[model samples]
Target chain A: MTSMKTPVTLDLSAAKVVTDWTHTANLLCCRVDPTGKYVVAGAIDYTVQRWEIATGKKTVLVGHQNWVRTLGFSPDGKTLYSGAYDGRLLAWEIGLETPKPVKDIPAHQGWLRGLAVSSDGQRVATCGNDKLVKVWSAADGKLIRELPGHAHVPYCLHFVPGSHELVVGDTFGNIHHWKADDAKPSRSFEVKEIFYHIGDLAPFGGIINLAFSPDGRTLTASGLHKASNALAGSRRPVAVSFDWKTGEKRPKHESMKKEIDGTMWRAVIHPTGTLIGVFEKQVGFWNAGVPDVAHLAATPSDIYDCDLHPNQLDLYTAHYDGHLRAMRIGRG
Target chain B: MQEQHYRPCGDIEHLLGRRQFMGDLLAGAGLLAGSSLLASPVGAAEVAKRGKSVVVVYLNGGISQFESWDPKSSLETGGPFKALPTTVPGIHISELLPHTAKQMHRMALVRSLNTKQDDHGLANNLVRSGRMTQSATEYPELGAVVAKGLERADFPLPGHIATMPAGVGGRGNNAAYLGPRYASVTVGAEKGGVANAKLPDGMTVTADQRRHDWRRFANSRFRDKVDSVEIDAYTQTYEQALRLIERRELFDITREPTKVQDAYGKSELGKQFLLARRLVEQEVPFVEIQPGGWDFHHNNFEFHLHYVSDFDKPFALFLEELAQRGHLDRTLVVVMTEFGRTPRINTGYGRDHYSRAWSIALAGCGIKHGAVIGKTDAKGIDVTDRQVDHRHLFHTYLQAIGINSSSEFDIAGRKFPIADPAVGPIKELLA
Candidate 1:
């Protein structure tokens, strides 16, 4: 129930495991409201839960028949959209006291792995294991257009702020960029830094998380660097940056030492220029100005996804152990 | 000399005419010496007289019981898939098997299997051979045992066949102790027909006959020089190869209509199952089809979703075809795995191998409809009632096919029990 309000300079070396909210089951994706007043998460148990930051009050929204893996909030933060493994998209009117889905669309043939609401909140985009990107009208759940060039399963998607462009990444290291009103890919590139497990003949790691730099000049794709074996979780967290205009690749950032290891599931770049990424068992922070990364937090179980507070000093993590954790990132 | 009973497909109708032509080509030069290749009875009554056959769907690596037959959807390790209700009242399985749920009435589910061996190789050997490791002797695998016990010498097709490469799961030489005659004929899963059964290009039918005569002539000369068991084995293999060549038309499953192939779903595993059904319908005695890659030590739910979805539809359709064709009463269908995955979620977000309690299913032949043989605890962690092991499963399969489980197999001057005498079949699973 503790509120993260304190403002201090960034010092991740002093960070610690702080808050644990334990009402949800094995969470997979999470997001912080635009105002940072609430945290919403999708859990494997087929429900989406929201937690009020100041009061720690929890509300569970249950309609999905299978694992709800990806979620997004409307620009105004008044509505929430969730995509589930059962191939359904549900839009919940979150401003209501007892929020229930206003519309439920059978969205895909396979599990929906990623969902994104447009900056104007007029349309929603979703990608799934069915290997198609679908856009829907936010108001009526009407299908807009289907984009189908991704040859592999897309894991995540993000809308570039203040622009109508969308970036989608797949199980392989391929990333596709599409503009509004376009059925074909506008641009595409391979982030070779994202490693795949060749021995298993399976996708080792793909783009797990992607975010645009505050100025939109750099695109950061965070995932495992080199997975000796994906099933064994023998992977190292890495974040690779690409210059948006030039498509020039930058040096990848390693979150841990060679002796230590974890898979990075989610990452976000704070407006203050701190690169925050959550690994399997640890969270890391690297100042865009400094070369070294610092440990921001540690957990007893794997963290599946994370979102930084809009205030830029606190973070929320959805865990594989069924806990929604929040950690203050400045001055301990 | 026998009445035609049933033709496997439309293409099989032309088999007898082709057989006559091939038989005439090889008849003159002692190549057919007392052996009537492709001249066996095609009578359905003769197939019935050969007793029942079995199709073993071996899943290779252990499949998770929770994700398939006995899901514990309420536990932490229950995973994301919910238990879907089946046609049989009160019976439920994972939603991953939606199609299979409709066919539950024909299935006998044994949810409590306590085979103590968890190592992949050992468990695989135990399940396939129905015995513990022996230092001095090797027991025949399930297919080999069935082949030896039920083989029709006059039939051209091999008694035991596997739609997989040889040597997987220690099965390369599964005919251990039974010698080579009852060995499984390996066929590629996706490759519809037997490999190398067709004559080399540019070799006319007459030239192929001449080559066979020349080989036999050389073999006879070599036999005169040395009397060895290896030579006898090689001679038998040569004869079998010649027989298959005469009846190679039966192996050309592509001759089946495209509609039939589509019914089988177009997956490699689906095609294998379709071929297995055809073999069993021909009364092959035993066919083993392995749809491998169930070793999900990570991302268990994700992989199981793909695996089960790929498996469920075609399997259900195959079972329906068997029932409609009347083969369900004389052919046994078995779905088995080496072990089951753990109920504990590992750090890598997957389940590890667990052997204390698992599941295997039986249907058709003498199996009882709508039967559930054993039970697992709520968390699917242990056997709560009627725990069965590999020995019990072996016995159940034998009994289902009307074979005597107590029979002895005399091999290498020793008598070995077909099934472990210490355990017996689950009587409730029997019709």
Candidate 2:
């Protein structure tokens, strides 16, 4: 029997490596339970797969007619909400032996690009290329309110923690802040100098993910940075953080090292207040007053979703090359 | 018994036989000589009053058949989009074209075209010129042929106008043997119309009119002193330029009402298509609107979503406009491309060039609407029935505009058939 070679030492000071569960197809979105016992990933193959973290057993959940681009889990981890390009939102009761469809709403007009569940798990919010953000009842799939402030197609959105505020980000770099209870938006912010494509005239890029600090003081929107030519998947990853209260953007932008080729798909802030972003095949962490730390060749394909473990010592990522990877980070 | 009797005007049989004899004589002599002798003043007036026009919206780069039309949802190659029911019964297209689906009754689709050339440049030339490059002769393009065949001396505008410049199809032989006069007058391919058409700053309408009068006087005096074919051609060019200057308002899209403009979405492609309709209304025989960027080698679905959605609304509005204005019977609209993308997708989730089976759509004047003329296999990889090529489509276009597909034009003393000699028009596609 042949023995495997020793692993190479990585210069990751704040964290260490963990198991990489990598065998899914082009995973677009993923959600981990609060206890980190199981993980569910929505994939380009139109199927949602739930992985048992301890045993690595896989159960495939199927219903979406197109690519499952967005996923949200209830606070209790009993219900899984998924949105797809077919403009459908399906709520799956995950506790059952075979995941059952609790409610299916023909949500948006076109591709549903964004999905969010309230912290209370009572309300679900969805946004799509139809340029409308809809809030629905998680229990009955009833409409709550329609927020239509997007001047362009929206791709990512989130609910401000500890409040009823919802911030929706679109392809045009316009961010709308809604009160969730109000019909009109409270305010809007524009990253006027930032764009996603290679040049001003090239095709537009969508905001892939947004993150908020634990204190809700900083809000960061991350995706592909502007390029000089075609958006041919060559642009680097970029993120801009804004102060929520003052609505003033941080003057300095954080981008991954030049070694990374493709754009970043998702970003999340760690419990230690470090901004960690997932790129095409790697992840990077940016801490204030320090050189940005990046890990290259972490996965084989583009990482579309990055979720922080409840313990804050582990990082889980879903990839476009069909991978669900986990990296253990600790204060060694 | 009555046919046997001789009369001053001649009996029906005698008149018919005489007309056939004259046609045969003219055919043997030459086309130009015969045209003058055969055309009568009354017949010319009728022909002018009901003249046909064609507007070709060339979706440059091979668009994916599975995403646009002929979507085979049952196959693995079908991608994510589902086929939606069009206005035509037993026919369905990609769901992305919801607006176009409603107006499918006014359009006929040809789904089985096997052009055999996958290279963009070669296929573009084949589709536009209707024949392979010839070593002995340069053949005219579809637009050039239409322009030369349907040209009216009284019409001030050029016979054919291209909203954008040509693509992939090299610029070498656009006019070919037909010469520059019959070539397309390219307008807003980029910015959406003739830029220099507007008068210079501080130039008033009165000054423009006076300058035009002086130029015409000078040209007339020069023509009297020196006359040649070259001189005549130059004078004709000068006259056409002056006419365009006088009627430049036709190129201004702002003249359209805000409601009408909004219907077309105000995109550059939409505005160019709107300008094409206006040109058709002005009696231009042919207009080609070039909306490129279908060469999606990386993110085919994303790009198609953008391009196809951009095309759907404005195109539907254009078809409706033609029908409402009672020009449907005399104006032909076509949506086509160089070829189609492959059915097998690559790792980038994109499809490359596939020429074995594809689709093109035709509508309006003399076209059988709500018709699906051909079919592709389950995987859209092969032509299962009613296979066609560029030559057959070109012939059908010629026949749709009431042009004689078999007519031979003398180019440099060499005869050139309007359509290819080997292939004939699709008789079933014609009304």
Candidate 3:
């Protein structure tokens, strides 16, 4: 592993593969532990797996009864929380020698799409098909309060780092802001670019992923766009950013390189102010301040989720090909 | 007889004179061409007793059985949804169809379907026609067959009609050897009512009436001079067209009461179901509507959530509306797809096409309500008990409407056994 103790340049174009490990099933959602020593992912086969960063040893944590869609980690890195399509939320002690379930409960009425733990580790915000955003106790998995304002099913939620404030995105492309500490609804805005319908019918793939920039100034929503024929899976990957403080949408951000057919399933902000969007066929990284053309790298399989290791150099991706991939940024 | 079948406003009555008129028309046409329609029985006595009608809802691109009728959610192959109990005890379907689940008491499910053919075109033909493809012969689809077997020969409107998306509609050639008389006319799901159904704006009502009177007189004079089959068929078509023009408003669902339209909702499938109701009210024997885009080879679960949500409510409402209107006892409503999806989830989080095991739903008419027959194995890869194929369903459909499947179709002196004569109806499914 390269040391970041000395100053090093970050170059996405020259990113190199660091570690790649296999899972028995396709991984849907993934997260890097707070300690940055382990990466955890939830799989299609109903298991939460944690891999040791150095040994590459995989530990399967089974508890979820359905396809897990989102994962959150406690600030101490001792506990891992997974939200699944079956609406069940389970917390596991990932730090234990044999990590076991710490808490489990039915969190929503339907498929739970996103889960986010506050940086303080006191509050957890989640959203699902029930068209609700809920804040819960991270300790016992009890309901704190239901923050309801979304007109459509919400797919992703994220906490503005360092604070309990939250942002949630829905199928209609509406984003809601909530003061998580008080569990009250604030302002909301809809990005029509991520939502579309023909007549009374709408196809899937909305604002599926949400992430906050390190400085909490920019919030980016990621999903497929320009669905010419949603029925036939006619869609392209895209990312849309907004000024977090003013709630104003920025110019459309999309892959300007080789044309691709699927969606930008997940977007994460790099510590260096770069916005990284992972698509089904490619991963794109661009400086958020640059405003335009992104550096894209073709992936071997459909990438569903990705997380940046605390080391700020290793980016882990969960893929549909039943593999967990790691790549080092600025290899050149 | 018309009074027995609930018409509209609860004051409906069958026009016996129209029945006699249609019979006379059939006999007159038989004299011109010696057509098989007359030799073949026109209407079933039982169907005529209540004015039987059929509505078929085709789910384009097969839906996965695991996600609907025959869920194995406990098993690894069950995907991510839970199996929800319906109105009927011991009968549970996928939670994705919560709306349809409430209407389960009025419906029967056939879970163990082994249609075998996975190709869209072939499977569609096999299920709708109830016959395996034989190179030398093509059969009329269900709508056409139902139109031929159950029609009272009374409707000025086409007995067999398929409601489609606004532009992709016209005359369908699925009637096969049954001839154009039994073929279906295509209409819009939401927008255009019927193409060319209106009189020219320049022509007043009086002018159109005069033209109609002149055409009838000219047609009678021509018939007296030349008793040609082509002329008779043409005259029959022209007259029906005139009648259809008079009732053109029926095809426009926007004209339906606001409450009624709201009940059916605004989705294309919803409006089509509403249109099916309007046609059924006018005694159109066979009405079909296709809610397409079911082929979920990729993103199956995500799309199914969208597809099922769109389908669930309107269908349940259709059943409720039919029951309230006293049509449930006579209208045979069916929801079917070509096949079921694979139990194995693919790399794309989708279920591929699998014909070994699937499902279809039937309700109303002679179908046994709340009856669930057959079962698939735990993995949902194959039928484990009482497996029924499309042929059995065809026979059952005919039997439900009081048509004897063993009867032969006298298609211009060539004998064609109705419903593939080899397999019989699922007696358990018949009330």
Best by TM-score: 3
User: For all the predictions, what are the DockQ values?
Assistant: 0.31, 0.15, 0.37
Write candidate 2's Cα lDDT for B241-310 as tens digits. Answer: 5566467678777788988878877577888778888888887998988875677765677677777888
TM-score of each: 0.83, 0.83, 0.87
Q: Candidate 2 lDDT, tens digit per residue, A91-159?
A: 998867779678989999989989998888888899997989999988789998888757788878898
Candidate 3 off by > 4 Å: A1-4, A11-16, A139-144, A179-190, A245-251, A287-300, B1-50, B74-76, B165-169, B188-198, B217-228, B248-260
Q: Which has the better TM-score: candidate 1, or candidate 3?
A: 3
Residue B5 accuracy (lDDT) in model 2: 24
Chain B TM-scores per candidate, in order, are 0.85, 0.83, 0.86
Clashes of each: 3, 7, 1
Q: How would you class the docking of model 1?
A: acceptable
Query: RMSD in angstroms, all models?
Result: 8.5, 11.7, 7.4
Model 3 agreement with the true structure over A98-186: per-residue lDDT tens digits: 78787887888889988989989998888888888888988767888888757788788888789878888888787777775554567
Quick one: best DockQ, which candidate?
A: 3
Candidate 1's DockQ is: 0.31
Query: Chain A alone, TM-score for each of the models?
Result: 0.92, 0.89, 0.93
By TM-score, is 2 or 3 better?
3
User: Where is model 2 more than 4 Å wrong at Cα?
Assistant: A1-26, A196-203, A231-234, A251-261, A285-293, A309-315, A321-332, B1-50, B74-76, B133-138, B164-173, B189-194, B201-232, B344-353
Please, what are the lDDT tens digits per residue for candidate 1 over residues A48-77?
A: 888888888999988998888888888888
